[model samples]
Target: MLTNTVTMTTVEIAELTGKAHKNVLADARKVIEMIGGLKSQPSSLGYSEATYTNKQNKEHPMLVLDKHLTFTLITGYDTGLRHNVVGRWIELEQVANPAFAAQAITETLNELQARVNAMAPAYDEHVRKGRTVGYSWREACRLADIDHPDKLLAVLVSLGRARKTTQGHTQLHPDYERDGFIKTLKPSNLVVSKNGGHLFKITSKGLTEWLKAKAEEMNTAVAFAGVDRWGRPIK
Candidate 1:
C-alpha cells in the first residue's frame, strides 16, 4: 500500500481560513523555526519553502507543510475553521492515494451490486425509474444494519463524514460530498428530510467505500463485506 507524501501550501491555508497569505506564511515560518532549524533534507523536516507566482507574475515565497505540520499549524484556530483545513487535507490524501481510494470504491461497488442482486425485484424497480445511484439515508442505515438513523448519523458526524445542524437535521459532510460518497437532495418523502431542509442520500459507493470502513473501525455494524442485503453471516 504505497502512498504519496501529501503537502499543503500556506497560501491554501490562508484561503481555507480566510486569513491573509502573508500572515499564514509568517505563521508557517514560525512553526518551522519552533520545531527546529532548517535541515539539509526538507522531506524529513515536514515543511519546505517554495515560491508561487503572484498576480503580476512575480514569484512570492510560501511554505509547504506536510500533514503533521499542517495540523500543528492550525491548532490555534477555531474548531469550525480547523475543520476546513482538515477537510482540505482529506481531499489531498484522496488525491495522493487515488489507487487505494479507487480500489476501495471498486470493492464497495461490488458488494453493493451483490446486495442489489439480493434485492433484485426492488432494485429493478429503481433501475426502471433510473434512480439506482444512491439510497435514502434511512434506507442506507437500514441496509447497513444500524438500529437507528440518528445513531448512524451520530457515528458519521463523529467520524467527520457528516454534520448535525442546530435544528437537529443531519447533513453530509462537505468532504464526503466532494468525494462523491454522499449527495444532498431536496426534501422528499423517500428520505428522512426534517426541518424542511435537504435530505442526505448515501451513494452506493459511500455505503461501503467510506461508511463501512469507519463503521467497522468503530465496531458499529455497518454493511458487511461479502454479505447480501440481509446481512447473512459472511464467514
Candidate 2:
C-alpha cells in the first residue's frame, strides 16, 4: 500500500513494523540527534511533530517523516520489515513524482485516443447512413456533437420541420416522414413534471439532413469570410 511521505507518522511506522510507538519515537529522535549533533533538530530528517487521535479519542504528539527520512528510519529495522517498508517507500516516490504522473496520464490518453481512432470509421458510417428510428433531442444533439440543442430545436420549429404544443409536446418534421423514418409513441410510464417538456424523437434521416444543413451553413460562412475550412486566409 502507498503512503504519503509528509503524513507518515511515527504511530503509523510503529504499526507497520509492529513496534511500540514510544520505541519508534525514540528511534526517530536518535536519528534526528545523530544528523544535527547533540541538539535535537527533527527537521534534519524531515521529521515534524503532529497530533494524532488514538482509539480512545485522545490526541497525542506524533512524529511525521518525509520520504528521505522515512527510508533512513526504516533501514534500521530487520531484513523482512526493511524490505516491506522499502517497497512501500518506492511506491510513494513514484506517486509523488510530477513527471511520472504526467507521463502516466499522457500514456492513458494516447491509449484511449488510439481506441477511438480505430472505431472512428465504423462510427462515422453509422452516423452518416444508419437508421435511428427514435432518438430524443438530447440524444440527437449528442450524436451530432451539437452544443446548443435549443438553437437547433428553435430552427427546426421555425422551418416547419418540427412542431411544439403549448403543453410542450413536440411533433416530428414532415421531411422525416417523406424519408421513411418512423417515430416511437410517447412513453406513458414517465412522470411529467410541471416544468418538463416532451422531447420528440427524430429519425436518422432528420439527423443526417440537419448535419448537412449545418455543414453547408458553416461552408457558406467560411466562403463569405474569405477563409478556408481550416480558417486560413484564402490566397
TM-score for each prediction? 0.41, 0.37
Candidate 2 residue pairs in clash (backbone atoms < 3 Å):
none
Q: Would you list the C-alpha lDDT of every candidate in the order shown?
A: 0.65, 0.58
Per-candidate alpha-carbon RMSD to the true structure: 18.6, 24.8
Kindly list the per-residue Cα lDDT of model 1 for residues 1-235, writing each as its tens digit: 6469888999999999999999998877755644542446876878877999989999999988887788767765555566677666766667777765756645644553344345445534543322355766666545544455665566567668666677656677677778877777654445455422435667756665565445444434333333567878666
What is the C-alpha lDDT profile of model 2 across 52-89, one tens digit per residue? 89899998888888766666666556555655554454
Estimate the TM-score for candidate 2. Answer: 0.37
In model 1, which runs have C-alpha deviations exceeding 4 angstroms? Answer: 99-235
